[model samples]
Target: MSPPHAVIAGAGIGGLCSALCLARAGWRVSLYEKAKILEESGAGLQLSPNACAVLRKLGVLERLTPFALAPQAIRIRRARDGATLALMPLNDAEARWGAPYLVVHRADLQRALLDAVAHEGRISLQTDAAVTGFAYGSDGVAVAISRGASRLEATGDCLIGADGLRSFVRQKLSPDDLNFSGRTAWRAVVEADRVPAAMRSEETTLWLGRKAHLVHYPLRQGTIINVVAIVDEDFQPDTDNFWSSHGASKFLEARFSRWDKSARDLLSAAPEWRKWPLADRAPAARLVSGRVALLGDAAHPMLPFLAQGAAQAIEDAGVLAEVLARGQDVEASFRAYQEIRLPRVTRVQKESRRQAVIYHLGGPAAFLRDAAMRALGGETMLARYDWLYRVRESPGQK
Candidate 1:
């Protein structure tokens, strides 16, 4: 008998990782990417120990290490005075969580996953292929693929929708609204020569303020720093355009005018800036429906506050692959994967939302929040997330 086959939609971190996991589990995998050319966007991502372990298990960690930055700590401070509040130690993260924390450019990680997928014989990848919809038949699940003006069909024992936030596959499964929080985020990367020596430390730094927060961390071995500034504001999205070249400097200049010179200088040094509204969906009790199921952003689009958006998706891929390897009915496998995953992702989503609130506390609330953070100290703060980082998974079963 032939090995079971799986069809994956989208080729982002989650999709590519899912394809690799399924193929490694003795399943023939077909991955469909909507983009004609898979270019790495200029953005950086944080890989906590939990996500790094999964990547290591999939055999992509070594390829990623060359581009990864292992920060020693995360420094939390006040945006106005730049006074250090607490330092979350990350140097010993590997010893504690069983894998090291890493930061890398989004493109580098994608390249590594794409390279691994290319070498795997069981996985066939198709670019310019968008999964429009899917249907379940007696033999298997049939998926509609749209390529330019033509539409084609592909069949597999099961279909996995790893497509990102604006997934067409998700809309087909159920109408889950992407709620835009009254907040907007600005992101930019500044080269090492442009940043001051003090700001380019081998640690992640966060500046908290009134109704806004700033986070910057080293990338490319400190040659560049990825900066993100998020502020609470009302926005009406064009619905057509998810991102635009807005005047990030102007917006940040006025909002963070009162912040310390260090923060202002970093903002000014960025050559260019881009803006996007933060959005998330309400947690759904059921992430699986029949032979078609969801994974990654399509399944749970959480806020970036927790830095677990990608990590949760990577975890989803690992669990989904393991569950499917059980040799159960296709529908049962998907249901099992969802049952094991939904609770954890939902909790992370809630925590991410809560962090957004805490990071942007105003006036008296902000003061008390800082006081609590200082009193709790960095080690305790990191300990609070032990449940998240200590998760261990094996391919045998859930």
Candidate 2:
């Protein structure tokens, strides 16, 4: 008898990671993408230890380490004068969390996953093919696929909606729009030499101010610096072509006009900026509705304040593969996947939202928050995240 097959929609970070894990577990997989040309895009993202462990298991970490940097710590500063608020030491991250905390360009990480996916004979990735629909039977599913003008059908024991925030598959399962968070994230990459030496350090620097905050870190072996600035503001993000949206440098500088010279210098160093409005879907009641299941942003879209957006997506891929590879019923496995994932992802979502409020605090609140940071220091603050970094396997896997 042929081995069970799985069909996946959206050949993104989550989808690609899921394909790798499933293929490793003895499943034949068909991965589909809506774009004709599959090129990775996006700015920088921090992969906390939770993500690195799974990447190590998938064998993508080795390919990634060369292009990424393991920042020694996260330096939180006051935006008004660039004074340090707290230093969350991460130089010993690997020894403590069982994996390294890597800061990588989104494209580089995607490339690493794509490279691994290419070597797997059991995985078939087809660009320009979109999953238009799917039907779940008692044992498996039949998927409707579209590639430009042509249409075809593919059958598999399971279908995964790793599509993304505005997933077509998610629309079929649970219909809801992703609500904007009344904020905008502006991202840019500057040459390391263009900014002050501090911005080029092998540590992620976060400067927090009233109603705004900025994060900057070095990428690609410290040749370039990735800058991300978030402001409590508003914009109607273009749904169809959002990531490509560009912002004026003057507008960005004006927003940070009151910020410290150090902060403004880093912002000015960025020659151009691409922006996206932050948004999220509320935690779903369930991540699985049938053989069709949600993964990554489709399942739970959360604010980036926690830096777990990508990490959580990577976690979803890891858990989904483990559950399905058991060879049990597909829906049962998906339910098991949901049961394991829902609570954790929901907590991270709530914490991220709360952190956003804390980061943008003003006046007495801001001062107290800073004072608390100083009181706790780096090690204590780092200890608080142990729950998030530690990944416990399912009871059966153990």
What pairs collide in candidate 1? none
Candidate 1 regions exceeding 4 Å error are 395-398
What is candidate 1's CA lDDT for residue 55? 95
RMSD of each: 1.4, 1.5
lDDT of 1 by residue, 279-323 (tens): 878886778888887888898998889899899889999988888
Candidate 1's TM-score reads 0.97
* TM-score per candidate: 0.97, 0.97
lDDT of 2 by residue, 155-216 (tens): 99999998987889889987987888988998899999888886788999999999999999
Instruction: Quantify all predictions' global Cα lDDT against the true fold.
Output: 0.88, 0.88
Q: Which stretches of candidate 2 lie over 4 Å from their true place?
A: 239-243, 393-398
